[model samples]
Target: MPEIRPRSTIVVTLLCIAGLAVAGVALAYCVHLGAQRDDDTGQSAAEFTYIPPNQAGLAADDVTPESDEVPEQLDTVRSKIMLCTIDKIGTDVLSVHTPDGRKHQLTLSPDTHVESAKGNEVADLTTGDLVVVRVIESDTATTVDLIVDGRVSSSIPDN
Candidate 1:
C-alpha cells in the first residue's frame, strides 16, 4: 500500500548480512572446541593408576635414648613382569593379555610415554603383535612404564 523506499531496503539487507556473519563465527568456534575435547580425552586416560611414595621407618626417627626403641616397618618390594600383547596400540592405552590367559588393559603415563622408532614403526603394529612391557604395582592400580625394546614377532599367536 505504501511507496517502496530504497534506503529502508538497503538497511534491512546490511542487517541480514551482519546476522549471517555472526552465525558463521559461532559455528566455527563450536567446531574448534569439539576438536580440542577430542585431543584431551586421550590424556585423561593416564589417571587410571598411581604409585605411592615409600614411607617406611618414620616412627623410629622420633625415638630418644631413654625411651624404648620402636621397630621400623619394612618396605615391601613389588614384582615386575612381562605383559603379553593382545591388540594394536591406541592413542592412549594398549590392550594386553596376562600369562594366565586373562585380558588386561594398560595405559601410558604422561611421565613414561611411548615413542616410535624408524619413522612411525610403532604405529604400524597391528593386532597380535608381540610386545614386552614393564608394569609397576601400586595401591590404587597397576601402571605401565616402558615398552621393552623389540618388535612384534611373527611367532606370537593372534588374539
Candidate 2:
C-alpha cells in the first residue's frame, strides 16, 4: 500500500469545493433569469411557449402533444413570428425590413399561405405592405409558412 500525501488530499478537496461553488452560481443565475418579467405582457419571460416551426399557424391551445411528438419534416429548426414591412418583391421571394432595422430576404414555400384584404395570392402583395410573417428556420433553408397583411389584422400592436 502506498502512503496518501496530505498535499494531494488538500488539492482534491479544494477542487471539489470549487466545482460545487460554480454549480450553485449557475443554478442561481438560471433562477434569476426565469424570474424576470416581460414588461409588455406583465408576465414572466419564462412563461412564453416554444411553438414548433411546423405549428406556427396553430394557436397555443391548438397545439397537441401528439403532433409535437412527431415532426412533419426532418432537419427543421425553430420558428419565429415577425412584423415586417415589404421592402421589395420578386416572383417567389420577398425582401422585408423589421422595426429593429434589420433587413431579411425571405423565400416563400410552395404551399405558403397568404391572407390579405386585397387577395389571397402572393401576386396581390405589394411593396411597402406591412405583414406578419411566421417563418421556419432550418440548417439548409428558411421557409415562410404564413403571411398576414397587418393592415387588415388587429394582431399588430400599436406603438
Candidate 3:
C-alpha cells in the first residue's frame, strides 16, 4: 500500500548483516571449544609399556647382586622414580608433582593400566593425594604404569 522508503531498506539490510556477523563469530567460538575438548580426549588414549628394573639397569639379578659399577644400559634407562602429589584426577589423565617440587603432568590412557588391590581408590583420589608413580619416559612425555606403595594411604602396608 505505502511506498517502500529507500532509507528504511538500507537500515534493515545493515541490521541483518550485523546479526549474521555476530552469529558467525559465536559459531566459530563453539567449534574451537569442541576441538580443544577433542584434543584432550586424544591425549588420554596413549599406551603404556612396562620396563623391568633389571632391564632398565636399576636392578641386577636378585639372586646375584652385581657390584656398585653402573651398567652401560643405565644410559638407556627411560624410567625413573617419582614422588608426586595428585593435583587433579580426571576421567583419563592425572596431574602430579615431580620430585623437584615442580608439577609434572601424566596422562591415564586406555593402555595406561593400573594394578591396585585397593578397589575404586583411583576414582576416590582427590587433589593433594601423594602417590609414588613409576613412569616410563616416552617421545611426548612420561607415562605411568605402576603406582608404587607408601604414597596411597588406602593401600595395605607391605609385610
The lDDT of each candidate is 0.61, 0.85, 0.67
By descending lDDT, how would the candidates be arranged?
2, 3, 1
Residue pairs clashing, model 1:
none
Better of 2 and 3 by TM-score: 2
**Candidates' TM-scores?**
0.38, 0.50, 0.41
Tens-digit lDDT string for candidate 2 (1-159): 998778988999999999999999999999998798756677676575556677778775774777566444555488999999999988778789999999998888788899998899888999999999999888777788999999944566684
| Candidate 3 overall lDDT versus native | 0.67
Q: How many residue pairs of model 2 clash at the backbone?
A: 0
Task: Kindly give the number of clashing pairs for every candidate.
Answer: 0, 0, 0
Instruction: Pick out the ten consecutive residues of candidate 3 with the lowest summed lDDT.
Output: 40-49
Top candidate, metric lDDT: 2
Superposition TM-score, candidate 2 onto the true structure: 0.50
Extract clashing residue pairs from model 2: none
For model 3, give the RMSD to the true fold.
19.6
